[model samples]
Target: MPRAWWRQLLSRFDPTPIPDPLWRRALVSCPLARRLDDERQHALRGLSAAFLARKRFHPLAGAVLDERIRLLIAMQACLPALEQGVRCLRGWRELLVYPGEFKVRRSHHDEHSGVVSEAEDVLIGEAWERGPLILSLADVQLDLEQPWDGYNVVVHEMAHKFDMLDGPPDGVPPLPDGINRRDWIVAFQRAYDHLSNDVARGRETLIDPYAAESADEFFAVVSEMHWSQPGLMQRAEPSVAALLTAYYGPSPAPT
Candidate 1:
């Protein structure tokens, strides 16, 4: 290859590395990521750097997004991509942060009734297909302090992003080579049905009842459990838990 070709390739692919101090500080703040083994942690640093380079951050509503906090968010966002590698982070380019909960005005249409209703939804995090990743700064900080709480706004929204990769969020993201798509769909559908039944009967449940909302929401909620409380998920749905572990790699949550 010509020397000019090498420079262009480098500019396109090689992102600026995170400085050692920034990496250490960000890692220290993110307990979920701090639990990764040294090799994976190093890999995460590179991924985080790439994420920061490729994604634009829009801090709105007085969201205090400093360099350290930005780096912290990048590290957590990239944690789920460690095993999948950087390819999984493609097709998106924005991260929007709010100081706290944000409200979105949404329109809902009923197919059978031909009725449309508009409502405002208060959200901590949300992801749209081929759009920006939105998050709550307060929730992100809370997850950092209570790392094992089985709730992470960033991870939950990121799961939706992953699910939307191949197409719409149908609870199944693009699978890796070893993971069978049929098996994944079967396991997740079974678990979603079980949870839906329990919620319908008004029974106590292990996984969040919000997961019963839809297939994609179930996937996102379980993904939060996978990173923060895999044991809880294992107890609720063994097969789904197993598949999630296989897809995202082992949970860093304390055993």
Candidate 2:
């Protein structure tokens, strides 16, 4: 049988459905998931079930992991993939949760000098290309408590996953039918440059200055706004906002 068929057959035996009580509890805690329309909410439920079925979750550093918490995480993680379908979640299998912030060491190689410099960076969440999705459980809970704060660790990392689906993240994910690749590149490029300029001038910006770091970060940061503070995104970068709206479907976030 084909790979797709084999996966489908396996899914038939995966016991991943969230019970009604657990689902209701999770929805009550997650404003973003609660705000989704009925149609999309239904899709999210199925996609989340699939996520739980396919991915392995490991709680580290004595982080408390429970069914409710897992369901909550799955719900938010699947939001970005709602329109794209569960297939968008392909190419990853592990979800690592830490109690709080984690530190990761990085080695930067200077291309001209060929000097390797090392540094440690703290992260709330991280998504690796074709690897595990790492997150801080505390940060995930914080996002639930402050859903409209214009930041969402799960969404941000999931955006990176989407961006990396085709290759290394360059701010562009695989476009769906009816979305012009050239148009996406032009609009994203202009928006990214504008934000980069503002950050360089030390001006406060509506979109996160972190987004100005690179095209991929820009896409991921704007994606958080697309779901959390879409009005701000629209005002900051109408073209990019429109593109995100088209790609992610209408914002369930309240204006």
Candidate 3:
């Protein structure tokens, strides 16, 4: 039978609503969702439903269509943008999920001679400008099954979406009124500098060394740690905690 024209048109704009039972079961099964209370779980479920309904989950070549995989991806993608607003994910719709870590070629200039060199990266997730958000199912599934500290690829990529909202993926986002942008600049700058110095000296640091690369990376790294290790960031760097809280509200404290 030929497809109905109205259905096709409607489906373009309307998202698929997930069933309550399926959603609830997903929360119980995933370790990452374990930290959330009932209320938070409910909110997350709603957000995921809306997200999955609106966005396109395009499995990479040889990928399977599994309920668990889609649920896991949806929940993670929505969590970071939950507080900010659903509009944060607007415009982008496609998601490419790979079976495992994929190779990406990144080209950069050599400082001295401005020679462009290409390097391969085993990436877990990568978001492109006006393109699909790609993820490694293997890596993310393991993370979901066994929760880790301050390293969430889902949140990390979503943070990029937020950072890219205003302009290019710069470290800064349009903060709310209460947060002083200047103060935020000073706080993040000092913190990034400190972390960069520690990484250079080969010393242990709470946040990842990748943060030192750029302001955008710093925001993404700190956003992951801010949610994963909220208490630590709060106690150790009050300014960072305050800034995050202003942007995303109080998140679940790390156990």
Model 2, residue 140: distance off in Å is: 0.4
lDDT of 3 by residue, 90-186 (tens): 7578889898889999899999998999999988898876678888888777767655566778888888887777778877776767778899899
Q: Return the candidate ranking by lDDT, descending.
A: 2, 1, 3
Give per-residue CA lDDT, model 1, range 1-255, as digits (tens). 223423443567899888988888887889988898877787777778788899999999899899999988888887778678777888889999999999999999999999999999999999999999999999999999999989999989989999999999999999988999999999999999999999999999999999999999999999999999999999999999999999888988985
Q: Would you list the C-alpha lDDT of every candidate in the order shown?
A: 0.89, 0.90, 0.76
Total backbone clashes of candidate 3, pairs 3 or more residues apart or in separate chains: 2
Task: Look at candidate 3 and tell me the lDDT of residue 24.
Answer: 70
Pairs that clash in candidate 2: none
1-255 in candidate 2: lDDT tens per residue?
223433453466454567898889899999998988777777788778889998999999999999999988998898998767766889999999999999999999999999999999999999999999999999999999999989999999999999999999999999988799999999999989998999999999999999998999999999999999998888988898899988988888987
Q: Which residue runs does candidate 3 get wrong by more than 4 Å?
A: 1-14, 31-34, 37-39
